[model samples]
Target: MNLMYLTFQEDAPLYLGVKNKIEGQISAFEKLGYQVTCSMWQDNRFCFFGADSFQRPLDPAKRLMKQMTSIANEYIGGHPFDVLYLRLDRVSSDMIQICKTARANHVKTIAVEIPNYPYLADYMRNVKYAKTLGTKVKTAAKVAVTAADDRLSGRKLKQYVDAVVLYGNKADSFFGVKAMNGDNGINIDRIEPIPHCADTSKDIAILGVAGTLWWQGYDRILQGMSTYKKSRSDGPALKFVLVGGDKTEMPEFRALVEKLGLSEDVTFCGFKKGKELSDIYKTVDVGASSLGCYRRGLTRCSSLKAREYCAAALPFLYAYDDAKLKEDTPFALRLPNDESPVNMDRVVEFVQHCRKDPSIAKEEREFAEKNYDWKTIMKQVLEFAGASMK
Candidate 1:
């Protein structure tokens, strides 16, 4: 099968989620003996467009549309693709054109990874096309419910797509998509939880926090930890380690820690990659997924960090109510609500429990390997893209 993958951004050195998803799928397709061509708006030269020297609201839509149309016309003109796999927002005129052209060429399949909500400008664009286009657009229900509030609008979007692949039972009804129950007949070969391995073993009970702490309730976790310190005095010294590239929000976080007299207990290790990040994960006794309340319907979808923590086999503490810490996940614990001051005690208790039972850490790694590994998810995605085992 010849597959063409699409995205909105230009390629950059940093590994973003959309890029990672595309790369994972491409790797799976190649492993299955498929020829994959990834065409994006920009190459490695420019990480992002419209950031420099461009006026406010610089629209790359026109350029992107031209580029996509040209690529489809040139590469897929005479030689039709077996599948035009799109991981794009619907609003892109380029995406709409690509789908229209792909269907016109009688391509066997056209699949999309739907956006969380259909109201975003990009999503609205895609929803508009899906309404008219007779092609099948695959999406996740966990995503659809984020932006869509109106029942009629959600149903209208679903009608255009052929199938909906839901992440969990809760998402199925919300988005009105067909439930594959995370087992959509797709083969997942490399699904395994990762184990946290530290480079040098340390005595302190290190708490590793990953992802955008500012965007996802990092303040709540920090505040909770501060409150927990006031109540407890005797235990292995607990240190907080935050990992991720974005550091714009670090100053405020640092200020809070200092105010709480936690300067010595906290460490910020800027952007890490590959084995470095994994090694850091190993040092920590517990992973923090301090997601706050699902304001405007945000936390309904599955979390990548939660999965990664499980993969590393590090017990994690999350803040959301609906967030499920899978039964197999040994070290994983969910807090009632990280937003309020009340949950601080619970956070401290959960951390203390993991410290006593180190075996739970081993269980978390085992569970991650079994379910949340990207290898397994990619395999399922490939089958959905119509790859045959033969």
Candidate 2:
């Protein structure tokens, strides 16, 4: 089967997690004898004009519309695809037309790869429910605009798409039941567990990868570490090594570390990849996933970094509620979604426990291999795509 994968960003060097996921999917599809082609937006611009045109100021929205028009026309004119897969963070108006056009042009299957639903209104409600005073004020206006845009896109998607492919349980919680209702007329599909990499580190260490920090809860991590440190002056020595960050972001994060008095405990690995990353993973006993919500109130996330840690045979911790990872997946540790400092303390203890029990580490690696293998995941995706054809 000929398949097309579409996403906004394809830069793997900067966005390691997304790159790995896209490549993994492609690899899996190839193994199943499916031909896959990927198209990505560069510099957040879908279509670029000549250098002269680029030098002058241009309206971004207009440019996007023109690009969308061109892409739509091309697909309409190009070879017929068995499946058209969209890796979308949120639904948009232009996407609705694109999807409609694809189906109109005899595209057999149209599926969306959704990590989680960014329900801006629901998020605003969550913030209010949590009584996070300043947060509500800071995000109110942006939330209003995003919620309006996404809801419209989401509704259109429900009307047009054959299947909504959920990366994790969080997406299911947001849309699964609705999809099943006859009134909704939407199919909800889950991504089969993909295989994880093996642990190659020799020492016990905690690993962290810094991406866009705002929603990642880096500050919470430092606060938790500070709380943990205060609890035990002579606790087991554990290293928290962070990898990835640009020049500007590094200084901001460093300031937070110093402010929390965790200078000695936290080590910034700057940016490393390939062998250096592999070596770092080898030393890590636990992969420190997200500490809190990407959005202040929402607990749903399909974290690619968490998968990477699991692949590395390191037990991972995430402090998000309603993540839907199976209980039998003992490699994953879920912390309470609260502001309590105890969560950090628990993480500290958990890290030490995993260090002491080789069996636990072994279990994590085994689980990753058995569950997250991309080859198996691709088979499931193909099956789902075939179902969509029916």
Candidate 3:
């Protein structure tokens, strides 16, 4: 069987997690005995991996959407793939046309994955990513042209797409197709569990890891820490270690830290991987998942960070609704789904409780194995797509 996997992310550091995930999904397909070809757009060219290796240069003069639709039509018309899987770049008319092309070419099992269903706000929020006057103006101009483009495009999804893969969502149908819902899974065998290292005698270390736009609602953490610092001088010291976030959006956070006098307590370790990341994980007492999802107009989600934490057997904290994890889940501490400050005292108690609980490691690892493994999750996705699963 031959599978074609398409990712909309460029080959860049900012998209490293998404790239790694694509690799994991392809690896799962191979393990399941399928010949896989992966495609990515980078350096103004379409880069395809596996038995089909080629680079198709994108026209620079025409707009991006036009180029992608033409490329999808030309390529799918010539290729034979048993399954055509696309990681949608939000909703766009180009994507609708791309799916239409694949179906018209008699391609079997065409499916698209939308990371967020009501993602228009998040998509429009990209305009705030500009750090300079030039980029700001450019992004602003692009937003004006694009804000209305995706609205009607969503309705066309059901016409050609066989399945819409949704993660950690309870929705039965989306875009007029039955959704293939699952957690944001990890390559469990590849991701070694972070050894449990909860030492609460001196200070408890809480870790947060994310890429691109990590909205953990750390402002609430800062507020809690500030209150904790003012209220008590020495309740088992708490330290926050944040990993992977853009510096362009760090100013306000930095200023908040300064204002709260927590500059010395929070440590930022830009980007880490391999052994360096492993070493940091060894020192972490607990991990942090998305705390400010409500701010993004999200009430529930399947967090990749939470998945990584569970795979690492790291006990963690989260506020919003997790796809598989419940508020009563023993291995995790759940907070309120609001913008209020996280209570530092309660956090300390939670850390102490986690450290004392002997079953934390076992429960966390078991939970990860049960729900967050890529092979199992992808098999279900493949089955839902009407593929002849082995």
Best by TM-score: 3
What is the C-alpha local distance difference test score of candidate 3? 0.78
Worst 10 residues of 1 by lDDT: 46-55
Q: For model 1, what is the error of residue 186's alpha carbon versus the real structure, in angstroms, after optimal superposition?
A: 15
- Which wins on TM-score, candidate 2 or candidate 3? 3
Top-lDDT structure, candidate number? 3
How do the predictions measure up, each by TM-score? Answer: 0.69, 0.75, 0.91
Judged by whole-model lDDT over C-alpha atoms, candidate 1 comes out at 0.52
lDDT per prediction?
0.52, 0.60, 0.78
Clashes of each: 18, 8, 0
Residues 1-390 of candidate 1 have per-residue lDDT tens digits of 666654445444343444555566677666666676665544422121111211122245455445445554544455556666555443334444556666677666655655343225433344444543343243333236534433444444333333334432244432354433332111123333344334222334445444445436666666766776777676345577877534555677778888888887788887675577767766676676646544323444455566666666666766543334553344766655435643554544666666666676676656656665555665676565454444
Ranking by TM-score: 3, 2, 1
State residue 225's C-alpha deviation in candidate 2, in Å: 2.2
Locate the minimum summed-lDDT window of 10 residues in model 3: 193-202
